[model samples]
Target: MRDSEMTTCAPTLLELQWAVRRDVLGLADGAASEYVVPDGLAPQARLAIYRNTANSTLLTALRLTYPAVQALVGSEFFEGATRRFIGQCPPLSAHLDSYGGSFPDFLAQMPEAASLAYLTDTARLEWVVNQVLHAPDGKPLDLRRLEQLADADIETVRFLPSPAARVLESCFPVDVIWHAVLSRDDSALAGINLDADPVWLYVHRGTSGVAVDRITEEQCRFTAALLAGRPLHDALVDGPDAGTSVWLAHLLASGCFVDVCLSSQASRRATGRQVA
Candidate 1:
């Protein structure tokens, strides 16, 4: 049979499941309703339960990920906007914490945002924070090994960022906005200059918790390039902005890197105690 013929034919159980998901997310009309046999109550009523649960779970997930966005916008407005977002973007990851990564893009294009020009950037910052909070505890870089290496290896050396590291660049003063919103400091928030120039941030998790720190553009460039798997030499001289040893020192002190390698193969730091 042809492609059209397959759709016209009766769907299997798996196809019905996909159709139900599409309908639940409001991506399709209620065509799946015809397939669901009414059990005690109408099929639509049963499906409504699933919709409510899914929507509620998604709302909670977004609330956790985008707390600043919720605090910036009132609860009523946030819930309304998130509901629309949920309909458009169904959860792809099994983990709720992994959802809502695209919420910043959604906020950027929202027509209702009149005076709140910074909401989108604020959301982007929040998403980075959320990622750092959930990132795995990967092997940290061996600084002793790095320091012991000869000057030649250090030049061509590659470093991998800790799984928890994230860099964000935004036109708005989103770090200040995030701090004000999360801390509930009305004075700090009121004093913000929304039209400030672009800001670069380095986000990471530590013993103290997730830290979002403002950084220079040069630091941002170097850190971002290393995160992109570029060698240290390339990242240092890759752009108009040049990185210094001070920047490298600062990042290393912040525990930004997790692994180092002289060439392509990674050189992991040994951690386990000697076993019997």
Candidate 2:
């Protein structure tokens, strides 16, 4: 049958789904025109209702994920920006919570958000906060086991950060801004100097909930290297002025890592052995 003939006949389920999806997204003009409606109901009008509902629900999720951004830009302006964001980045998964992973990058590229350099970084912090909150719980690495390792074994072993741990490095004082917003203290927000130096942050679940801590450059480098799967010896760069013991103690105390494993090469190097 011809394309026009198929439309005249009953629409297939797949065709109907595509039409509804396009209408919800405000795409083609006549994607939904062929649909059958009751006498009182208008297809375009009904689709408009659905379009509004879909956009509203997705926008709500975006707002929740980036509340700080919404607050920085006023509610009305944020809503308008969010509508634009939704049009460009639609939901891919059934779960709304999994959405907006690219929103930070989207804000960075948005023309309106261009003036606010810190906006993208703030969005990133918010996303990491959400990720930490949803991450599964796990026990911290055991200190006793770490202490028992021989010096050679220590260098050959690797450290892994907990599933919930994340690092955010920003040229702006995003941590301070996020804290100020959380505290709801206008004075604190005013006192924060945006011209401050760059910041390295360690975000993870603490005794309470998600905890954000400002870390030193040295700590950032070491933790980042460890997280990248580098063995401890390779990761231990001599920059942090802080002694190795102090850095190690702080890392263990923070509970950033959940497990430790010896690299296979560690054994081979120990006994002058080689694997075939």
Candidate 3:
């Protein structure tokens, strides 16, 4: 064949076979060819061992991310759930940490988990905890700068929640459910009820470690507004029962708010006013 004809030819059968073998091995399914198998082992058996190892490694990662969910569902049920979850939502990111982001939603729709309505939310909280642990740290807002703002400026300033923070709301009492699963002792079980109304929760990293706190619906809404870049006045317009001063104090005390920004117009006004 001429050089041009040879260059245009398709891959050989051996090349195709090798490609399949590499793919299968990378996915932990072992080589499809018997060439690599041990003398005593069947090709299928050797391949099965690879499949088992791959699944087990994946399952271990999944378990680490969704420990609370695993605890709630028990090991056997969680194993089955993880297998189903993997089949439906294979890892898309190179980082294993990015995997299992959809696991909570998957559990919510699962018939086997229907009875455990809080299971999905618990999983979600666990996921948030993982995110907080891994999120990049940034310097918090300078309280000194905050003190310089006039009362009116405070109304126009937007506050940013910490990078390591996440808010979760669920119809099931997910905070209580998380506590039940994570707490070493269950002594405070008197008023704890799973069927109670939904609750809002905040999970964030602190000086010690990742921590979860139960928060009010109003706090959730206010924080969400701030995070969404709404001005302070606009955020407080629909905030829970308190005057702006009182609400601002409460927010500052929460330790969730970390940064601030003034609207462009407000910043210009402040500069002009100061210059005048």
Model 1, residue 45: what's the lDDT? 81
Candidate 3 root-mean-square deviation in Å: 7.5
Give one digit per residue, the lDDT tens place, for model 2 in 1-276: 356877678778998888888778766675786574635777778788889999989999988888888888889978988888888888776688788889889888889889999989999999999888878887999888788888879767887678788888999999989888877879988998889999999888888888888988778777787776678877765444557658677778878888877888545555575443
For model 1, the superposed segments whose C-alpha errors exceed 4 Å read 1-13, 34-37, 147-152, 238-243, 266-276
Q: Per-residue error at 10 for model 1, in Å?
A: 7.9
Clashes of 1: 0
Query: TM-scores of all models?
Result: 0.85, 0.80, 0.73
In terms of lDDT, model 3 sits at 0.73
Write one digit per residue (lDDT tens) for candidate 3, span 116-213.
76677778888888888888786666788688888878767877777787788888777776677677346634456767877888777778988877
Q: Which stretches of candidate 2 lie over 4 Å from their true place?
A: 1-19, 27-40, 143-153, 238-241, 263-276
lDDT value, residue 92 of candidate 1: 83
Q: Model 1 compared with the native: what TM-score?
A: 0.85
Looking at candidate 3, what is the lDDT of residue 72? 70
RMSD of each: 6.7, 5.7, 7.5
lDDT of 3 at 133: 83
Q: What's the distance in Å from true for residue 172, model 3? A: 2.5
Q: How displaced is residue 225 in candidate 1, in Å?
A: 1.4
